[model samples]
Target: MSLHAEPEIRPVPPRPAYDGTSPFPRTAPLLRTPGARWQLAATAVIVAFPFLAVVLAGWVLWGNVLGPVDVVLAVVFYVLTGLGITVGFHRLLTHRSFTAAPALRLLLGVAGSMSFQGDVIGWVATHRRHHAFTDRPGDPHSPFRYGTGVRGQFRGLVHAHVGWLFAGDSSPADRYAPDLLADRSTRALARAFPALCVISLALPFAIGWAIGGTLHDALTALLWAGLVRVALLQHVTWSVNSLCHMIGERPFRTRRHDRATNLWPLALLSFGESWHNLHHAEPTCARHGVDRGQLDPTAAAIRLFERLGWATDVHWPDPRRLDGRRQ
Candidate 1:
C-alpha cells in the first residue's frame, strides 16, 4: 500500500457511553420519597404560622407591646443570621471566597446553623445546584421555570420563593458539597441540625427572658426575634432566587440563563446579596456589591474579619476585571 493510503481502520474505540450514569458514584436522593399528604400540610402550616403571627402582631400589638426593643432585636437578629448565610454558608462554604481561621470557621458554621434554613451541607448543595443549572429545569428554584407569561411568572415566583423546598427532589450533597462533607466538624454539625434548630428557636426566648425578666417579654421576643425574624430572612433569601432573577439591573453578563440582578432595595436587608448579577458573574469574589454605591454589609464583615486576622485570602472585586464583566 502507498504510504498515504489509509490502513485498514481499526475498530473505532467504543465511545464512552454515558448510559445516564454520572461519572461520580450515585448517592441516595436527599429528600425522601413524597411524604404523606398530612406531612406536607404540616410543613405548610408551620411555615405559614410565622407570617400569620407577624400579621397579627402588627394588627394587634404594633404600638402597645411591640416597641423599640422589639424593633432593635429584630434588626440585630436579622443581621446576624443573614450574614451567617451570606458570608458563612454561601460565600465561604459554597464559593470559597475567603479563608477563615478555624475558630471563625466553626463560629460561622454554627451561626449559619442558627439561621435554621437547613443543614450546612444541604444548603451548600442546594445553592451549588442553583448556580449549576440556574433558570434551567434542574435548578432547585428559578422564577423562570414555569414560563414567561404573567400567570406563569406568578406561579414561578411563588415556586421559586418557597414551593421548591417542598418538592420531592433534592440536590445530591456528594456531587455538590464534597468539600463540606469531607470536613468532619462541619459534617458533625450538619448531623446535629435538629438540635441546632431547637437552640435557634429557644435562644431568643432565653435572651428575652434574661433581659426583660418576664414570660410575656420572652414570648414577644420569641415572636418578633425568632419567628418573625426567620420569616423575614427566609423571604429575603428567597427574593434573591425569585425577585432578583425577575427584576433589577443586570450590569454584568453571566451564563445565558443566569438571570441575576442588582435589586438595590434588598441590599441592606439581604446583607448586600441583592447584587446577584455581580455574584453570578464573579462567584468566588467575597464582595457581591462590587459597584461604588452598592452597600454590602457582608463584605464589610469579611473585611473586619481580615483585619482581625480571622480571615485571609479575601477576594475583593477588581475594577478592571469587573469592567470586563459589565454588559
Candidate 2:
C-alpha cells in the first residue's frame, strides 16, 4: 500500500451526556493490565530524570555561566517539539482541525514523537478518550477526579498534572485511533518512536559538539536542550490538564462537568493551549485562542499552512458557534 495513501476517516462514536448522578461507562480493558512494574519504572525514570536534569542545569548555571548556544538550542528544540504536540498531535492528528499534505503529516508525527510524549497514535487515542469523558468518570486525566472538596481537589490536581501517567490504564488505539492505525505512515512513525527519542537528544549533542568543540558543551546541550526542554514542555502540557481545568476565566460554556478555563499566564509558554475553555467548547476549531489579542501560535502556523496549500479544510471557528457557546 502507498505510504502516502490517505486513510479513511473514522468519526468518533457519540458519547452519552454525562448524568450527574452516575459514572460514565467503563472503557474497554487496556492493552496492558494496570500497574505493570516495567511500565511504572520507565515512567518514573522518564518523569524523574528530566527534573533531575533541571536541578543539574541550575548547578551548572551557578558554577559556569550558561552559554548562548545552550539557550538557543533549548528554545529551538522546545518550539519544534512544542508545536509538534500542539499543531501536529492535537490539531491535525487527533482533532482533524485541518487536513495536511501527506509529507507534512509525516513530518509532524516524527517531530511529535521526538517530544517523548509517546507514539502519535497513542497520544491521539488518549486525548480523544479524555474528550469523550471530559472531567467525569473514564477521563484518563481530570483535575476533578478526586472531587471538589479542598483536599480532594488538591490530590486531583496532582493526579491530573502527572500522576495520571502512572495510572497504567492505556487508551486502546484500536478503539480510539482506528484511522491512524489504518494509515501506513502513522504506523511506521509509531514504530520509530524509540529511535526518534534518541535522535532528539543526539541532535542537540552533535550540534553542541560541532559548535563548541568540547565534550562538556555537548553534555550541557544534551542536558538543557534535551532533558530540561522535555521537562518544561511536559509540565506545561500537564498544567493545561490540571490548572486549566481548575482556574481562570470560563467565557465559553462546555459540557457539564467540563471545567476547562482560559489561563492567560500560560498562553505564551503553552503556545496558546492555555486557552483551554474554548478548546473544550469547540474541539475541532483550528484556533483555540479565539479572541482579539489572544495569542495562538498553533493557529498562526495552521494559517501559514493553509496559505501554502499544505493544509486544507481547516476548521476555523465560526462566530455564531462561539457566541452560542459563550457563558
Candidate 3:
C-alpha cells in the first residue's frame, strides 16, 4: 500500500439541533439503551476479575503462589502483548506511524488480540477519537470531563480510569478509523476477536501444563500469567487516560485543552505510552520518549523491525518539530 496522508479527524460536533417531534440522532452522554446494562455488567466483570485473580494468587488459594516459571511466563506475555498494543494497535494501526509489511502486520494484529484489549478496529477507532478530542467533552475517556475542583477531579479520574467504558461511548469505526475499517485483513481480525480471547487465556495454561505436567501448574499459570498479567497491563494502559492526564508534567505543548502529560514511572511498563505529553503533541511520531534517558522499548522494536525489512517509513522524531512542541 502507498504511504497515505493522515485523514483529518475532527472532534464530534457540539449538540446538533433536534426537533421535539422525534428523537434525533445523537451520541449518548451516558448509556441509556437496554444493551447498556449488559455492557456495564461485562465491564464490571472485566475490571473485577483480575483483581480477584491477583488476590487469589497472593493469598486466597493455597496452590496459587506462582513459581519461577510462572513468573517468567507472565513477564514474557506482558512484554509481547503490551508491545502489541503500544506498537501495533496504537502506533501502527491507529496513528499509521509506520508502514508494516503484510506478514508483520498480521503478526502484530494477532499478538495485540492476545492481550485481550479488544480487537484492532475498535481499538484504533477509540484511540483515534481520543486523539481527536483529548480532554475535551467528546473524548470517551478524558480525565477532565467531570469539570474542576477536588470532588469533580476525583470523579473525573474514576470516569477516565474505567467508568467511561461502561458508558457505552464507542466511536464508530467508519467515522474515526475508516482506513482500518476498509482493510480486509483488519476486518477479519475484528471478526476473530472472540476466538482470540479464548486463546489469550488458554495459551498460558497450555504452556504451564506442558512444562510442569500438573493441573496445579496449569491453574497457577492461568491465574498469574493469564488473568493477572492482562489485568495489570489493562490498568497501566488505562492510567494513560486517567493518571497521566491528571498528574504528570506537561513539558510539551499541544492543542488547547489537551491535558496529556508525561508520567515517567510508567515508561517501561506502558512501553513508552506514559510519555503522554509528547504523544499528544505529535501523535504520529513513532517514538513517544524523545528525550535522552527515556526508555521506549516500542520505538526500539520498530527500529529493529525496520532493520529487518518488516516496517517502513517510520516517523522518527524530528528535533526541529519536537523543539517547537517543547514548552
Candidate 4:
C-alpha cells in the first residue's frame, strides 16, 4: 500500500426543497402571545440560574469562579445533554433517522430530557413543524418572518432566537408528532420532563459537592456546569435559527422563501447542525457535515451506536443523491 493519498472524494452538490405550507395548524398569530405554563417555568430556571451565576461571579467568586474542575464538569454535561437533544429529541424521535437498541433508546431519551428544552413530544412536534414549514409563514421561528428589510430582519432575528417561544404559537402534536403521542412510554417520559430538568441541574451540583467537598467548590460547579452550561448551549442551538438563516452559504435550494444557510463557524459548537443548508435540504440525513472536514459529533455518535449494536439504519449521506440536488 502507498503511504501518501492517491485519490480524493469530491463534495456533493445541494438539492432543492419543496416550497409549501406546513401541516401544522395556521390558526394562531405569531405575535406577542403567551407561552405554555411549562415553557414559562423552564424559561425561568434557564434564565434565573445563569443570571444568578453572573451576579455571584461579579460580587463573590470573581477569579475563582470557573476552575479546571468546573470547566470539565460543564464540558462533560454539555456534550451529554446536547447529544440528548440532537440525537434523542431530533434525529431519533423527530425524524426516525435511525433505530436503536431498547436500552440505548431509553438512555438517549432520559439524557435528552435533561436539556430543559421541552418534553419529547412537544420538542418533536415543534421540530417537525419547523422542517415542514421552514422559513415560511407557519415556521415557529423563522428569521425572515418579519421581512427582508433591515429593521424587520433585526426583529425577525430576535424573534427567531427566542421571542417565538413566548408567541403562544405551538406545533400541534396531533398533526406533527402523532407517532410520539401514540407511544405510552414516550408519554410517560414527557410527563417526567419537569422532574428531569431538576435532575439536570441538581446532578451537577451534587457532583461538584462530592468532588470538591466544599461549599464554594459546589457553588462554582453549579454555576459553571449547571447554569452556564445550559445558557451557552441554549444560545448555540438558537443561533442555528437566528444567525444561520440570516447569513452564510445557501448552496442548496430550499423553497423560495426558505433561507436556511450553512455556517461553518458553528460546526463544532452545534455538533454539525450548523450545516443548516444540508439539514434543511435533507432533514433525515444522519450526518449534516457530509463534506470533507465537516465535523459532526452527533453523526459520529450515531455511528458509534451502530458499531456497539445500539443504533441501526444509519442514513449517511449519499453523494449520488446529493449530486442530483445541485442548485
Candidate 5:
C-alpha cells in the first residue's frame, strides 16, 4: 500500500441488546480465526531471534567479545526506545495523558517503533482494547485468560507474555485508533515501521563501526545494542502484561476483575509502567508511579518535555482522585 493511503479501519461491532445477564458486553472473537500461519511465522521470528541473540550475546561475553561501547549503545537505545513505548505509545497516543509538540510526537513514534513492538497505531489500539477489557475475556493479554486455577494461570501467563502475539486476532486499528489513522504524519509513520526496524539495527552497527573502526565492532553492536536491547525491553513490557497482574500489591481499586498491580522490581526497567495498578486506576494519568518512593522515568521525561514546552496539558495525578481510588 502507498504510504499516504489510508489504513483500513474495521468497524467495531455495535453492542447487542443487554439482557442483564452480564455487565460485560458481548465482544468480538478472541481467538477463533485461522489460516494466519504466515503471521504466526513472522511473529515467531520477531520474538525468537532476539531471544537467540541474547544466548549468542552470553557466549560472546564468555569470549570477551562484549565491549564498553556496546554496553553504552545498548543503554542509550534501551532508554530511547523504552520511553517511546511508555511515553509516546502508551501515554500520549493510547490514553492522551499529555499533548506533545508535533516534532516530539513524531520522534517518539519513530523511537517506539524502533523498539520492535508493533507499529504505533496497532500498539495503541491493542493497548486501548486491553484497557477496555482489562482482565476480562476481551483483554488481549490478560494473565487471567484461562481461569483462577494454578494450571490455568500458568497457561495464561505464557499466553499473556508472548503467545498472544501469534493469536492472529488483531485489534482493529479503525475501531481503536481512528485518530492516528486520520493523521497523515502518524499514518506515514505506521507505514514506515518496517524500515524503522532496519534502522534500529543499522544505527547501532554503524555507530559501533565509526567508533571502533572494525567489522567486528559493528557486528558486536548489532548483537548487543540491536538485538539484546530489543529482547530485554520486549520481555520487560510483556512482564507488565503477565507478571504484574498475577503478583504484586494492588493499592488502588479498579474495575471488576481488573487485577493490575504494582510490581516494584520492574518499575525502573519498565520506566514505571509496572506500577500497573495505578495505571489501570487512572489510565490517562501521566505518572504511573504516583506514590512516594516510586521511580517513574517515563513521567520524569514527560515532565521534562512539559518544562521545555514540548509537552502540554499533562494529566498529573490528583490527590482527591487518588484518595478515591485507593483500596
Candidate 6:
C-alpha cells in the first residue's frame, strides 16, 4: 500500500479593497412621460413664433410702414435676451465657468427667463446632454447624426439646428444634472417656465404702451421685441449646433469624433460662443476664446463678477492645459 500524501493547500490572495469608484454606476432608466411630449410641443410653438414674426416683419418692411421705434425695440430686446442666454445660461449655469453671488444668480435667472428659451433647468439639462453624447447616438442635437453624404448632412443640419427639440425625448435631469436638480431655488424657477413665458411676451408690450401710449406701439413692440428678438437669438444659439460644427477653424484637438469649429462671424452675436473648437476641447473653462485677440463678452462678464466679489472659483484656461490640447 502506498502512503497517501496530504494534498497541498494554496494560499488565497486577499480581496481587493473597494475604492468607491464605478465605471458605470446604476442609473435610473429614462422615463417616457406624456408631460415631456407636451413640453416639447410647447417648445416647438415658441421657436416657430419668431420665424413667423420675421416673415411678418419682412412683409411690413416691404410695405414701407415699419417704424424707428420698432427697430429700437428689436435691437434692445435682442441684446438683452441674447446676453442673458450667453452670460446667464451658458457661462454661469451650464458650465459653472464661474460662480455668482445669490443675488446675481437670481437676477441672471430672471434675465434668462426674459429670453423665453424655456427655464434654466431644462436648458441646462439639454445642454449637458449635448456635451455628454455630442455627435453620437444619444446626442440631443448632432448635425452629423443622419450621415456624412450631402443629402444626409442637409437633413442632419436641420435636425441639429432645431428639429431635435420637436422630438419627444426629455433628458433625465437626475442622470445628467444632479447639481441643478438638488438646488431647490433652481427647480422652482424651472417649474415657473410657463409663467416666465407669459411675462416675456407681456413685458415688451407693457414697456411700449407705457412709453408710447398707444395700442399700436404695444403691438409693434410685441412683434419686434418679443417675437423677432426670440427668433434671432434662437438661430444664433442653434447655429452653435449646426454652423459651428459644419464650418470654421479647429485649432484645438478633441476626442476623435467630436466636430466643433470656430466660425468667427458668430463670435459677437453668440457672445464668443463661436470659439466652439476651444469650447468642445475644454468645456468647463470659463473662456471659450482662450486665444489672444479672441474677444469674449461672456468671459468679460464673469471677470467683472469676480472683480465685484460676486463670483469665484472661475475655471480660467491655463496655458499649460492649452498647450496639451493644441493640435
| TM-scores vs. true structure, each candidate | 0.86, 0.90, 0.91, 0.87, 0.90, 0.86
Per-residue lDDT for 52 in model 2?
82
lDDT of 5: 0.86
TM-score of 5: 0.90
Candidate 6 — worst ten consecutive residues by lDDT sum? 1-10
The digit string of per-residue lDDT tens for model 2 on 108-209 reads 888899898888898998898888778988789987767777877888899899998987777778878898899898999999988998899999999999
The candidate, 1 or 5, that scores higher on lDDT is: 5
Please, what are the lDDT tens digits per residue for candidate 3 over residues 146-185?
A: 6666776888899899888777777888888888878898
Task: Output the TM-score of candidate 1.
Answer: 0.86
For residue 238, model 1's alpha carbon misses the true position, in angstroms, by 0.5
Candidate 2 has an lDDT of 0.87
Cα lDDT of candidate 3 equals 0.83
- Please give the lDDT score for candidate 4: 0.79
TM-score of 4: 0.87
lDDT of each: 0.79, 0.87, 0.83, 0.79, 0.86, 0.78
Candidate 4 Cα errors over 4 Å, as ranges: 1-49
Q: Which stretches of candidate 1 lie over 4 Å from their true place?
A: 1-46, 55-63
Which tens-of-lDDT digit does each residue in 6-45 have in candidate 1?
1111232343333221221223444553563554564575
Evaluated at residue 155, the lDDT of candidate 2 is: 84
Q: Over 4 Å off in model 6, which ranges?
A: 1-33, 62-66
Q: What tens digits encode model 6's per-residue C-alpha lDDT throughout 227-309?
A: 88888888889999999988899999987568899998989888899999999898878889988889888888888889999
Please list the residue runs of candidate 2 whose C-alpha ends up more than 4 Å from where it truly belongs after superposition.
Answer: 1-36
Q: List ranges where model 3 is wrong by over 4 Å.
A: 1-4, 10-40, 60-65
Clashing pairs in 3: none
